[model samples]
Target: MSRLPPAIFLMGPTAAGKTDLAIELAQALPCELISVDSALVYRGMDIGTAKPPSALLEAFPHRLIDIRDPAQSYSAAEFVSDAREAMAEISASGRIPLLVGGTMLYYRALLDGLAEMPPADAQIRAALEAQAEAEGLAALHRQLAEVDPESAARIHPNDPQRLVRALEVYRVSGMSMSEHRARQRAQKAGAGESERSILPYTVAQLSIAPAQRQVLHHRIEQRFVQMVEQGFVEEVETLRERRDLNPEMPSMRAVGYRQVWSYLDGDYARDEMLQRGVAATRQLAKRQLTWLRGWDGIHWLETSARDNLPRALKYLESLSILS
Candidate 1:
């Protein structure tokens, strides 16, 4: 085996201080930050997406953020291509690529190659949406659990976008998303191990998480409250007024954005929106943690620890990826 150039991954649930830690790492090492988040790709989605403030973003200059309009869609395949390109550009400039975010599916697609799946079928998706509306998302999730339990376990009941897509895949192809992944894995296992990494560089993954579950829950609630105070509702309202956007679109379906969009649509009152938004965010964090636990070779640090920075640096130092 031969050594490949190194790239760093900073993964964590939302409100885990990943952005702050990435900034510190970029300042301390020769690295360029590349955002791995799905929601941050859209412009004008700042407050609800928890995007870094303009000043902070200007200073840090993360790649792959604000590169798309909310009306457009970004798929995992696109993310793989974009992330690989950014990684190569940074590596060519003799800098480490520090990828950071809580979007686990993006990270997974980048690391383990995405399975060859069918494109989005509008008819199938529309039927699933109709089913969701008629019976609620819980009913659809229950149906998914029967057909594709593996994906159902990973996807939250409230994550209608993913749930709809999963059922769509099953309906269109007669194969679950989990089955597609299994086939891909079997193919890789049969193939020779010559090309282990799809990306050019070897990856060193670092994870930040709170040791206590209640502590993380508290932070999630606090952060959502702060976002509301900072005009999250107003932000969603502006997006809602756009004729091209809708609540069903992928961008509008992001955690807080979706709930706020519902509030704006008169589906719920402001107080209910706040409660639902925070609860949805907590569920999102729980799902992210589930994804993180399945990954191998990650150095986990407690986000609430005072010495998290030093501990993270120590891990990088041990890997000889940082000075």
Candidate 2:
């Protein structure tokens, strides 16, 4: 059945109740959600990353969750390819593909192909991580700016994760991240000229802006505490038992992991650890919101009330998306 792959993408910031709302929509519509989250892909990572409970899965079908071990590497490019295949499979199964996640890059990768970024070099990454630990992330950002001014111009100094990656890329490839990016852009443009290879999904993005920053901050703090009570500490301890996994790995670098890691390393005091974890999560949410706002071709829904899903559904329907 060669049909237009009918699908929808629902995206929003963290702690926005997207999970339940997505399942609710499934009841009224014929759809199965594919996770677009980078964090939710890891197996045995439930509390901190907040993978949907088993009951939710029984209620509505989901793809791309628990697809990778915590120690393994998963990239946006791989996600794009796998998710494209998943979409085809879902369509073949006579199901609608409704994708959900807060990971902006994954969403973009699915909507428009990601440029081929070079693979990570372990030794180079270790060197960069060591430098960040010994000196500071600011110095690393400066180093990246010195080497890849173009990428540095776009990446904020506070974005230590991306800055370190850019530095590592330059270290391994002998090409500035800027040059690599330019080359990728050229290739992407060439691909665009031939035909649109972007995933053919009926993307519908929905979101609710927190009216008060303090409320969002409060939510972040509460969620961190809940995750802690929900065995996040134990989860990190299990990951710690992995002799190969480093704190620099993308999975390990998630908000709570780093803080609990510092605590386990006997570095941070109890109060400092909690504060840092909560603060990092807030910052992450802020960055996610920035990315969501900056994205083009995204349909946003700003709801003032708690039951925002209905309004979001109505918005999608208004956009000529059928139920």
For residue 317, model 2's alpha carbon misses the true position, in angstroms, by 2.5
| Most accurate candidate by lDDT | 1
lDDT of 2 at 47: 85
Q: Which digits, one per residue and each the tens of the lDDT, describe model 1 over residues 202-312?
A: 788999988888999999999999999999999988998899999878898899998888788799898999899989999899889999898889999888678877888
- Candidate 1's displacement at residue 260, Å, is 1.7
How close to the true structure is residue 133 of candidate 1, measured as C-alpha lDDT? 88
TM of each candidate vs. truth:
0.94, 0.85
Distance (Å) between predicted and true CA of 90, model 2? 1.6
Shift in Å, residue 302, candidate 1: 1.2
* Per-residue lDDT of 277 in model 2: 91
| Candidate 1: regions farther than 4 A off | 119-123, 194-196
Candidate 2 lDDT score relative to the true structure:
0.77
